[model samples]
Target: MQQMITLITNSISKDLPATLEKSLKKEISSLGPVIARAITPIIEKCSASAVADSIQKVVGDRVVNQLDKSVSAKLEATVARQIQMQFHTSVKQTLQDALRASLEAFLVPAFEQSCKTMFEQVDSAFQKGMSEHTVAIQQQVEATHTPLAQTLKDTISSASSITQNLTAELLDGHRKLLALLASGNAKAHSTNVLQPNNVPVTGPPEVEAPLDPMKELGRLISERKFDEAFTMALQRSDVSIVSWLCSQVDLRALCSMVPVPLNQGVLLALLQQLAVDIATDTPRKIQWMTDVAMAINPTDPVIAMHVKPIFEQVYNALLHLRSLPTTSPSDSTSIRLFMHVINSVLLSYK
Candidate 1:
């Protein structure tokens, strides 16, 4: 413990002079200002000019022989002041401008180059770091993916097997059900036909009973029930009904049985379907239109009331058909049928 204390004491002793010297320097720096302040007024009173004049007068007789016996003290002082003033304004300004220009020229390019190099280094480092990070992330993803891919494959395979088994079972059941129905299950397939009275009666179900919706519609029309037939036809959306309805009823007879609005509704439905059929089979539709228009006697006032609206509807459909550009054979045939409809209506009016 004594040796350690002695060693510490030696170290402190070695550093004490440096510490004292620093403190002495600090003290001297602090005193320098006070001393300067004390001497400033005295020094100012004995200015350079005063000092020079005093020295000159003191040494004037002595240096008279050495300094050029022709040069006076006053003349020397004036020359010195003039040189100082010129150097202060002119020389110093020129040197300052030259030095600034030189420094700017030297530093600007170096500064720009240094900045560019630094930026390039930073960008390169950033890119390298990003690339390394990306590589690490990709490696990590690859490491994690094998198990995930296997899990997904297993799950998908299991789901596919389950779905296929279920679908096959459903399809087999459906086929068996259909076959049993075709064989005429007594419980499922009832032997009954609904009559006009809507009473279900047991009868031999007719094989290949025509599934024609228009047949019911024709029966409705023949009964002079235009509204029911029209609703059924519109619900069916069957184009064949347009031709069948046209053939079954004389246009005037249909109008005579139904009210004007009901008659117009039926006519419009027929015309709309006729327009569709004309787009597909123009010649047949045109013939159908002509036959229907002929059934109208335009001169009869009662028929005229019904026939005028049918003509107008046909005219509108014709106008729409004509508006379609005749760019295809179908389009051209449709236009011809439209013209035939217009001509047929005009002839009925005549």
Candidate 2:
């Protein structure tokens, strides 16, 4: 039976293609039935029980072998044709499609998951690169901005300092001018006489006249007549002379005279001069002015009369100086002297 099977396989191999070729290529439809009939004899040779088994074994083996060979030949021919057409067409696309379909079937959800993971990885890398680029740009901007900000701050600081210094100088100039005006007014308005105490009774041909009011005050101070000197200094409303005398006199003794009702105009004039002077000569003069101004009874008509005019004069002077486009050297010097006087008076009060 094995021999018969082998023989039938070989015969079928040889005749089947011939029958199919005749039917398919030559247009001979009768060859298929003829081939079927030829195989029937081999089927009959086996016994009824053995026929089915024998025919099944033999025909199955022959059919399987033929199918495999035909499929393999067709595949080879298709591959050869594809290789030839590959240069003319996009073969990679075809291969990719075929691979994708096959992998999809075999890998199922795992394949889909792998594709998603790959895409995420690529996206993450792109985002990381963009973030790094952004950071670099920001750092560059900060590098430029930091210096610019610092430069602007420095410029503002310098400008502010200049403004402050100029304002101070202008204020000082105004006070000096006002004090000079006040001094001139005082000299014109005052009826006080100038007397010298330390002069010699007899003099040479070239002998100078007696010391002026300022010199006499100095002599009195040197002689330790501080009270008399201070009183004498206050008598003359010369802001410059009075200011100098106050500086030389003992402040403790000077303060004791504050409560006494003297000429308030003279006192206020003295204070105004001191205010201007202290602002320049000594910064602490403002405090002194505050103290002395406070010490004076605000209700006193005399104090008010004196304070009001001086305050108005000083205020007007400051406004005038501030409004002026330019200041002269003489005006500048006068302002300095006034400031010195104001400083000394205020210091005495403090």
List, residue by residue over 168-188, the lDDT tens digit for candidate 2: 553444344333333433432
lDDT, residue 95, candidate 2: 77
Clashes of each: 0, 11
In Å, residue 156's CA in model 2 sits off its true spot by 18
Compared with the true structure, the alpha-carbon lDDT of candidate 2 equals 0.54
Candidate 1 wrong stretches, greater than 4 Å: 1-104, 187-350
Off by over 4 Å in 2: 1-215, 222-240, 256-263, 312-350
Q: TM-scores for all candidates?
A: 0.28, 0.28
- In the order shown, the candidates' Cα RMSDs to the true structure are 35.7, 25.7
* Tens-digit per-residue lDDT, 1-350, candidate 1: 99999988987898877898999999999999999999998898779779889988999878877666547676788899998999999999999999989879998888989999999999999999999999999999989998888987886676556545443443333233223322433432211211111222344542332377667766778687765565455434556665666567665455454233243233433444465445445555666555445433466532344344445545555554444443366655655665675677667676
